[model samples]
Target: MDALGIAVIVAVLVVATTIGLWHRRTDGMIRDEAADKKRRAAILAAAGVETVEFPDRKSSNAVASAAAKAASGAAAAAVHGNDTVRAANAAARSAAAGVPAAPDLPADSGIAVPVDSGVPAPAGPVDEAASAEPAGADPQLAEPGVPGVREPGDVAAERKSGVVPDSREEPGVVEAAARDASAAGESLDQGLLDRLGIGPAQATLLQFSSAFCAPCRAVRRISGEVAELLPGVQHVEVDAESHLAEVRELNIWRTPTLLILDAGGQVVKRATGVPSKPQLIAALGDVLPDA
Candidate 1:
């Protein structure tokens, strides 16, 4: 072959290698987008604001929101000084301003005050319930300094989970699938299951497979074995090429995509590519009674 043909072959080889590496890098990743969406909605509700659904996981708006929340929490935590530090600072300022620091009083010191103020004291026993909180107002906010109530800084921190400044690892499917069942939003209806030839099943392991894919065979076996092991769980496989409409509607981007559905057909978990036996079992933990 001529040098030109040789160069062409080398370029094709490099391109193929790059594509294969990219595909291998992203294989077998399961996403828990439903839980992420619920968390974001709660944050918006707490702030008394609403935003359009996030375009995608990596959209600029989503990234900005996460960064802003993280920064706000770190700032709050840094500034919320301890009680001892605050007290010491108050005493130092009082000394500088020539104001006397108030004496610390014991908690059990029974003292009586003369009704010297213009306002008269209560005649009967003061109603603790009445003074506990204002009508229709939040008790915590009304008396933020009260001992048992969390301060605003702590509350803000609690709302946001820890944020890693820079991390590229994907979340584990098992960990994500363990979330509340309500967060699993995607579901297949009974009519659709009947059409797919899947009979009554407590949990369905629906897999989308393609003919040319080798990994699909392994996934088929794994899913079938799992279904047999777990009662009330049935394995159903679909040909992606033939079911074009279903693939498009379900957003099945790749072959061997597994969907774990509950008794009511809600998709509790999803994983793409070949999965291990333990991973599949863990993904089905929330849906199965004894798992």
Candidate 2:
């Protein structure tokens, strides 16, 4: 072969090798990116959040509509269940009061007495000795289904049907249940604050943020501004990713979650989104000293 032909053949071979290497590198980069995304999704899932792809417009609208309908149906079912329970309780009370099952009284307001078929009234006037004796009374005539008296079976039935019977113990049960509900609904107590290493302040704002969350930045800014405006108000920001244990303990499921703590470090208010300045100020006022 000629010299020029040999040089051209070598150039061709080099170009082919370069192209193959570039293709392999591109494929590896694509694989690595996919693996990284999968890892991130897995981490989010472990933290009680599922990563979702952006849906098309139509699918998004349909999903929103379905969610709204589901919510409405759930609310309606709750209302219906409450109403049914109330009606059952009212019926049970009415039955216990002898309001509906009581027999009609005599029109003349006279005592009702049952006469024996074969017995007749004495025609002659009663003697002094016989008149002095008291007349015999029938047990049934003395009481006509005494009001507010319930049988054991009836009480059990009412209870099984979700009607709380009127008894001395009922008030205590209701009070205890209310106390439990109040306690459950309340925010972190002093002991929990101490365990979390949160110090005492007049008002404290805790912000939970994730690394890739844009709204978290806005929340941080707002909380900082509020803290600067109010004296003795401290703002604490926590990385939701790094502090997984604390996030789980606080039940923080989303980024930019704000918890407003009172003087005793008890949570007074909480918000999930970027709250307005006025709203935050008002919430701080409620927990701040001398507000």
- The candidate scoring highest on TM-score is 1
In order, what is each prediction's RMSD in angstroms? 20.5, 28.3
What residue runs in model 2 are displaced by over 4 Å at the alpha carbon? 1-197
* Whole-model lDDT values for every prediction: 0.47, 0.44
- Relative to the true structure, candidate 1 reaches a TM of 0.46
Put down candidate 2 lDDT per residue, 145-234, tens digits, no spaces. Answer: 222222344334433443221222333212121111101112354445555567756667888899988988888998899899989888
lDDT by residue (tens digit), candidate 1, 64-154: 2222222222222122211222222322332344322212211111000001111322423123312221110111111001121123453
In model 1, the Cα lDDT at residue 235 comes to 95
Whole-model alpha-carbon lDDT for candidate 2? 0.44
> What residue pairs clash in candidate 1, if any at all?
none
